[model samples]
Target: MKKEQPSWWRPWVLPVLLVLGAIAVQELMRAQQPAPFSYSEFREAVAQGKVESVLLFPTRIDGHYKVGPGENPRTFSVVRVEDPALLEELTRHGVKVSGVVPDSPWMSIGMWLLPLGLLIFVNLARRGGSTEPGGYLAVGRSKARIYAEKDIPVRFSDVAGVDEAKEELSEVISFLQTPEKFRKLGGKIPKGVLLVGPPGTGKTLLARAVAGEAKVPFFSISGSEFVEMFVGVGAARVRDLFQQAQAQAPCIIFIDELDALGRARQAGPMPHEEREQTLNQLLVELDGFDPRIGVILMAATNRPEILDPALLRAGRFDRHVLVDRPDRGGRLAILKVHARSVPLEDPADLEALAGMTVGMVGADLANVLNEAALLAVRRNKDKVGRAELEEAVERAVAGLEKRHRVLNRLERERVAHHELGHALVGLALSGAESLRKVSIIPRGIAALGYTIQVPTEDRFLMTRQELMDRIAMLLGGRVAEELVFHEVSTGAQDDLLKATDIARSMVASYGMSESLGPVTFDDGKASPFLETGPSRVRGNYSEAIARRIDDEVRHLLEAQHARVRELLGAREAVLRKAAARLLEKETLSGEELAALVAEPGSGKPLEPPARDAA
Candidate 1:
């Protein structure tokens, strides 16, 4: 067999030859110099008078100039010599000076090419015959994540406060696991399920649980990911995504914020072309694919009304599940679940908290639990307690407790009175519930004092009279501030805002104002342009009639103010006492303050107002 030719390009051979060649040249160059001389040897030579003038090289000498293709250049320099004998003595020292020239030209050549060679070799190795772009070039590719059976991080237990939603998704999971079972019973499973709810209500969590329980492939992509600035990229990506899902067969594709890609194509001056194309592609895919392929599509969005009508029709997104805020029992379960992660000195009073947080969502409850744990850790406590948990809920809802917010003694007294005024008026109101607590500790963005109210039970169907009473309760603080101080301050800012909003909605939307007749004023569709819109139900209201609506709102507020003054006037002494007590304790529960409100042996009662009789 013929001997194999040596590979001149081998890395190890070239480096070894380079090193040996450098060493051999170095030896030859050193041979041209005289024997080395020590400092003492130079001194002896000077004593024998065999030395001439000495030369000294300064440290600041620039050696680079000597190699330039120009005028003759000096490579070394000398300082003042002490004697001629010393100069000649140093000459015998055989001190060698090095210039720009090195031992071997080949060594220099290798040094110059090393970094370039490394870069080229690395580029070639990484090429690996790939036709695709480099790592950074692929950044614009769809970042949609695909979760294999092994990659699902959350299950049913991680989600709380949405038991009904979880139950709905669990059925889908069952169908996915055993499609034949449902098919045998002549049941056709829904091709798509739309999760409609407010943001942060665990809509996405339910979808993940479906993936985890079913143990199938999970494809997650944000709705915005489908639309790119490039003209055809969006449509191409949508096609690729559907193809991949079909290949997997039994998989779940979760599109978060589907409204982004599914918005209705309105008759505007300009349409979002990229988004429209993407939505078209999605609709086509949904229509083409069969349900038997084992692919279940789950989409979530807060703005369900904005989606295209065709996308939500029969075959596509057939089932729409409303994931509203949890009821009291659901909230309790959520609290219990979240409490597991916290170090509790005493078990959290979940039932009590659930009653207080009537409108809180699952996300809000989780935050409350997290805030409570943080509060305990901040104080270096071993375990969290009820008080810490309560404070955390308030902090998370309002903001951090601003105990250090300074107030003059008079301002502090006024705030205490204002908060106590609210509690007292609420007690006087017939349908209103008792105050939960009163506190002068400033909280949130800007609250000097607060009176928390706790409903005994959830009230879903509030009558018109009850809503009017609630508005009266909200206005109590401002009324009290005016009655006592003969003027108003910013203490009732939140109260005024809530009261005005309620009065407006009652007149314009809920048809609670008798002066406005029994016709609805507006559909209460929130818009950026208008605070109040034209009446939804036609009415014979002119500009003059419109002016009367405003007058009616003012009249309602004034009447409630008058009612507050009367209630406080009768119990003036008790009102002052309650404010003083609030200032002393900084907090009071409903039962504790009820004793003071009920001092005359019975709770005050008022006759219920007639319907639409504001």
Candidate 2:
């Protein structure tokens, strides 16, 4: 990342500007306040009887006087000369004299020191010698944002979803509140609790909740912030952070994205790099701090796999709390939490929405509600009702609606038939998600139409039959195009890509293909640290086995395509009827689709044959 210098000014600029402004103001005021005169001049004025009443002090004399008699008086002052009869001269001139002690040096010193202090302040400010942590010379000081107990506004209640994670960290919060509860039982509070999850899984929020509920100091900083341009800045920051935490004992130090600062130490970049030194110092501090002292160290990172072993060892981040994506109940809870801001109508049922959103995490859920409110506002509705919320979910999953993307009549009919094929095949699968919606409307880039399925429940693993049915469903669109128009369009491109990957997974990773001999052939991560992309991925099999794997994948796809062709061919009449109804409505739910394909006031329903492990 490049650093951008502030074009306007730095902190020292304001006070320096203030000093100059003060000097200007003082000069302007001096002209009006008083004009100084010499003692000889004062005597000459007194002799001329032009002197007004004089207020005499030990060091100076102040009075109002005119240059000649009967002239309007003006203010003047003069330092008292050690001349005799000065008072007598004023008295003889019929000018009343009053005595006063001079103003104290402390008051005058403030006037003299004002500009001097401003200069000194600007000098120190420029030198970056901030005595406070993160000051100029204090650049080594930690940049962690400190929040006193009362300063934290969010508590555990504010953090909904991830109940398991909250429960795990609550013990740490409880320990902080009453250390004796655990200390008496010979149980040491885990010195550090590492919150590991994907991005936006509420790791940082959970840590803040802990600090709030525990009523302790909270220091938050990002891992990348520790290192700086200076050689030992990172290490110094680490030391300073630990010292401050120790001082405010009963405090929580929450480091976000710890992996950036704690990447595995080996050979790379400059030797004894600043980040490594910072990590070393951090390790020392983690080991050095006694949990009994009330300082609890916590860190969050999505990529826990890349963290240093030293950082993950017993004394450091001993407790690894996994804050995974929320379950159905958790999502519902999260929805309720975010929904409080929007005045949801009675029809806005969150439970159904949560069920529809199977794999969405907390952040995604929050976005859903926010998007719902935005949609309601766009539509000029009084409150967010069921229709608005449903649209929000669809908008979040698919891209925002692009109804304005007008397609030609031929293209529109093709999209309708293609999407119907997917819906029909998906409905035929026993364990597949229930068909929820179908639309000929364009959404997102490249998606001319879409068929949405709402999962009945989350599934961790799929059976061979289920995977096979999924592949068949993926091939349904192309088969439908061939059956109807007798020629397939490029609309089946995404479906084909997904089907190939699934077939590959089934053959290579799942060991489900008979020709592959039920042996696993998947490779580990590409870099052994980061996620794998297509080109980066390597195969564990030999050339001969790779050929066999490719053949097996091709065979599976062909088999699924054959099954889809048979299924759609048998239901040709039903497919036409459904497509015609979809063309009339432009959008349809499962109920509507089922009604369109229902037996004509008679026996068994018209549909594709089911092929799934229920």
Candidate 3:
């Protein structure tokens, strides 16, 4: 850690010291001044003809009077009051009275300087005390944090899960380390490399690693920091940043969240002129910088679609490197990288854990490991075990277990049946995700029960049958509720929404609707990298086609619902037994659930109890 050097010139410190010194001098002068004499006493002295003389000013009267004939004259000051009769009495008593204006040069100077000094002090304090670039005067200066080569601890080995992105950046690192090699070949390195990916995918980390590997200075900044409320400030900052980067040749300049500064300029009445100016300056810098100078400009953003096309053109951000989420092997690699510091039990199944976390990125994997370590400590265990890791995964997916939320007997029974419905359907389906666990215990915000299904492996493609099976599995809970209780509850709200979305995507996006005939009606606005919520449907198709689309979606869901109802209806006896056992145990692993489903029960369906009798 760098020691913070003592600031010699703090803006507030000087003002404070000056004020304190002034107060001290004022106090010293007060102590040296003669005691105050009351106006009444002065009047009485005048009446007794003991007052020798008085000097009257606008504010106060300074005078001296003899205590006795031989005594020295004592000086005293009295605050002036409106006493017209006193002056006449002094005249009548034949006392000496002089009207003299007070003239203290220092007092006059202080009176003129005090308010001015106070205003200056307030302005200085508000502008900030330190000489850092965040002060009002330094707003135009770049806010980039400069890091020397040795200061960056991250290297290629420290980053994982984005191997392709790393591979792409390796060439940039080589160019930085040996620009002469590329220059000799009459080839120029890419002036800029844009790292595009979803959030938490280690885009920024990869940039740091590039600098670390090349052993060059690194300048890291966010694009939003370039733009300010002032119109031309952002443009000035862009120029200043480039100047600093050029000064430190063979350095890497990284800007995170480039979309903030480089969004496509919209044609409208109200344009963001400041942002446009800053972006134009950035473009100019990119064009002006020489590739052979080893000043590599790198940027990262999740929203690349919204970036200005000019900023992403050839010879600008010449190459675009995708830092996508890790697959199974990548996830395993990431888990290992994060697990280096965590002490794990010898038999901890990291492979299985990695498999369970299918779509997790590097940051999420690190969080999982951290959460596992925390769980181990919470359970008074020295080493993190598979159980702790598994629980952490559950917490990550479903949320923290709400063990204190007690369910009534009826609710518990309903939740048990609902979860088992999902597990049984998933297990029966050939292409469905493998059932992991089923629990009636409440977890998360509103989940009264949950059933976890882990894919056997990472799957990038799914057949139409697989998608249908997925839909069936989702609707199984509601079907199970109807079969057992003869009525469905709102517990399957999330499941229905998910099933409907999948069915709609299959029809509109995947073109699986038989009647729609492979014609895609999707607006294509959804980001491929992000797991965003369902998009609002744009009216790209006619009302007739829209009605057809809605009809197809309803038919698909109704078909899956009917299939699930039929499938669970025949297995009602097994469902009843499994639900009873789940109520007793509160939780069941995949193996236990499979065993329950395999066990042959009496070939009889349990009838719903009579509502009137109850």
lDDT of 2 by residue, 1-614 (tens): 99776554575676678777888988899778776878888888888877778888888888877557676668889988787877677767789889876788898889878787867665666556434543446787888999998899988888887888988988998899999989889889988899988677799999999999999999999999998988998998888888889989989999998988999888956565878889999998888888899999899988877789988998788999988878888888888888878798873488888898888878888998888888889999988888888898899888878989999988988988899999888876676589999999999988999999888997877888888888888898899999999999999998888888888888777788887668877764333223353332547658898888788888888888888888888777878878888888999999988777775842335455755321
Ordering by TM-score: 3, 2, 1
Q: Which of the numbered candidates is closest to the native, going by highest lDDT?
A: 3
How close is every model to the real structure, measured as TM-score? 0.73, 0.76, 0.80
Top of the candidates by TM-score: 3
Clashing pairs in 3: none
List candidate 3 segments past 4 Å from native. 1-107, 110-136, 602-614
**Residue 344 displacement in candidate 3 (angstroms):** 1.0
Question: For model 3, how does the per-residue alpha-carbon lDDT over 154-221 read when each residue is reduced to its tens digit?
Answer: 99999987888888888998898878888887999999999999989999999999999999999999
Query: What would the per-residue lDDT of candidate 1 be over residues 315-363, giving only the tens digit for each residue?
Result: 9999988777788888888888888777777664767778777778888
Winner on TM-score between 2 and 3 is 3
lDDT to native, each model: 0.74, 0.83, 0.86
